[model samples]
Target: MGAAQDPNSPVVHLPAGRLRGATEGGVTVFRRVPYAAPPVGGLRWRPAQPRTGWSGTRDATADGPSAPQPYTEGGDPILGGHGSPPFDDDCLTLNLWTPSADDAGRPVLVWIHGGGFVSGSGSLPNYSGEAFARNGDLVVVSINYRIGPLGYLYFGADGAPGAEESGNFWLTDQVAALRWVHDHIAHFGGDPDRITVAGQSGGAVSIAALAGHPDAQGLFRRAILQSPPLGLHIPTPAEYLPRTGAYLRLAGARDVDGLRALSWPQLIEAAQGLFGETTRWGHWPTPFLPVRDGVTLHRHPARTLLYDAAADIDVMVGWTRDEATFGFALDEGYATATRDQVVERIAESFPDRAAEVYGAYEKERAGARPVDVLMDLISDELFRVPCVELAEARAELGRPVWAYEFDFPTPALQGRLAATHCLELPFVFGDFATWSHAPFLSGIDPEVRAGLGHAMHQAWIAFVRTGDPNHPDLPVWERYAAPSRTTLRFDAVTAAVEDPVGVSRRLHHRASP
Candidate 1:
């Protein structure tokens, strides 16, 4: 955590300035490197501006602040929030890792952290690029963007004040980060042309949007979307416009200047309040999504996704075996949840098909608790079905797409967590220290962790290295298609299955009205 200069550190020169990075554990790590100008003052609520070059070598040895976000006391059990990096408006920075800053022509991997578009930073320890660099021999980059109201709050049809491009600063910041990597990654031994964008949850949703985005399509050649809340769909500015007053009221701000004058903590407090005030459970995951602003983004990426513009881009999409099973951690009522409660939950998301959905779920999880049924139902609706739909959309265009499911249910809490929402992160990053606080890995077997971790890690590396995720370690993985719906299942025994969840996928068809 020290910011002192290390004489032996690697210094990579870029368009912005010279960046000195810390080398450790056989990888060079660059922390808190700015990709865009600080979104502050008049720039607040506006699209990200390009970073200006510095006069001298910029220190990239220490991690800076995370994007301004709401405070979750004691932190998130699954994601871990307490004792995390502090927040600031100058949060649009990125971290990079390279085996050596040479002309290796290595493929690059860029990560977008997921926090439901509300919280999360690329500087998170689990997102460290060391494993990718040391193991895969690839240049890795993880980036940050504005989040919550600061990044996503929308103005009316009149547009934002003091800036030309209106809302979706969140999405704009991402575009700028990808552009930064695409432009200057070569100085860090990364092949800009071979970049792959990877994200999970809200980050995954961002990748989907970036695919069709005019500004972001050419930034990366491949994409990996894990557990995106695609079923909820992206909201239009019209939908966002209604929520604007809540923030203004919270900050007592009539204009962008008045709002920006407030501290980040105050703004994030307002952001949390706005989301908590009226947003329902179904919309909770996307409380602050990048709006379908016709300017930067032409169409919604995951909801009824049609990526005709970026069809040629390779995609790898998947979810946890029990994606929604993690809902219990968020809400304890599921412990005593009843069939009535399950029906009510279904009605919120699908009112027209509540009875049909409930019946289908009941049949799927026969003799299971109502809470379990609700978890499975919400999991499919919120995460799995959308993942399938996204892959299906990519495949229908006659393009290459691979799919897989992470099924290593955590032995934590007597295995109540199961294979939950973010369980794959530790496995993917293969960093136990970063995930030390993670409740799911509290007492899990190291061997189990290492086995699945290596399998998933190699698969990701293979996908980034070559457009195909097929590696000899796993089975002959096939592209996801109709009927077979081949999906690689990650578990104690890594194997590829033909439509393993075919029954679950088909039951909805029978139940849909």
Candidate 2:
């Protein structure tokens, strides 16, 4: 039995089951497809196993359940509202959108949502694949993987029943999903050979981890890392063992069996309470992050990328102009800090180049408010600098790397927030009207803004299809290099810039991590 659909539906046969999706505006949309078995019960902290195949037709009309997360309200709502209802443990699923079921040679874009690895789902309306599917004629896939303790608990010598892994089980789930894509995307009109793994924030970090993994060597030929945090690579057990043990004990989990036996709500509460006031870091209530387990992740992502482990891969790396505005908005005082405090914090954060770097920003914008200065400094240190460093490192390896800076400030934020973190999502997804206050951001120039979306979306699709992003018809996107250090500036009118935020990069280079 199938849900009622338009007579012109696009039916595709997936390995798990046959699904029927509706065609809207020249694109086929399929939602809520499971890529792996549910990671619940005995499988909670284990590596994802292959999903058991289905025997009958399965409806792919809506989003699958999001991974378990704390219920809250009125903060950055990426996957539904902040107060949305809680979900279950079996949240390993994926959604797909394509131009046609017969267009088997089209490129594939797999998007990993960003919420510092805890919140956010692929089911957000802003992440819908319709526009990308219709405009670029490319296949888009978004997925949900385990998060928090369930996704990233670092197992120790306890070996409690299913506690077999040492690092990120969540990352393992991602690898499993990619493997599923390789095996089944062909049936849904996507070319397995032309896959691009792209993500932002924690998702970006995950992409970086995948890029470094030996198992992920040929899973995707290209990658796009947007705003990856410098500190997000899997940590060593030495760095997190105490915190992990404390969290386990707080959850009333005396052993692996006890931890597994704790209810999901009980686990979330224990993790939240353990994090205390520091939960602003966006998940990590416990010390649950990808650990440096020797097996899955051989080394840290940075070391792997720096050593040319992924040198052959094409990369597009970028950060926004005002990356830290969102962090400040989450807490107003963060933006209202004093100059001395800003410098002190910067020095603390980057002891290597604290004086030299802080001096440059302080001198350049001496009259600026403490919060504004802090904002720029934090943004660069956290996002911009790392992006540039990664690009520079990749360039040094003689790999083709393109760099970009998103400078368009969102109207919804008025002037308080510049092109802050995630502000470019609406433009990238071509859902500004649906996701943003269109009247404030676009005014009446819908057609003009619409053109940029077409161009940007096409550029991404081209990147996914061909390893290189330069389409002859589009603007010539030069590979990033030293000296000139050209970068594409995405805004109302996209153009190339010479060394976007060069001063900040220099300062960060001088500063230590």
Note the Cα lDDT for every prediction shown.
0.80, 0.74
Worst 10 residues of 2 by lDDT: 277-286
lDDT of 2 by residue, 416-493 (tens): 776788766666777664565332253325675677666666677778777766665456778998877889988777
Error of 1 at 17 (Å): 2.3
Q: What would the per-residue lDDT of candidate 1 be over residues 128-218, giving only the tens digit for each residue?
A: 8888899999999999898888888888456446544456788899999999999888898989899999999889988887887777767
Assess every candidate by TM-score.
Answer: 0.94, 0.90
User: Candidate 2 regions off by >4 Å?
Assistant: 1-9, 73-83, 158-162, 231-234, 277-288, 306-309, 350-356, 437-448, 471-475, 510-513
Residue 319, model 1: Cα distance from true site in angstroms? 0.4
How many clashes does the backbone of model 2 have? Answer: 2
Name the lDDT value of residue 371 in candidate 2: 73
Clash pairs (backbone) in predicted model 2: 352-512, 353-511
Q: Which ten residues in a row have the lowest lDDT in candidate 1?
A: 504-513
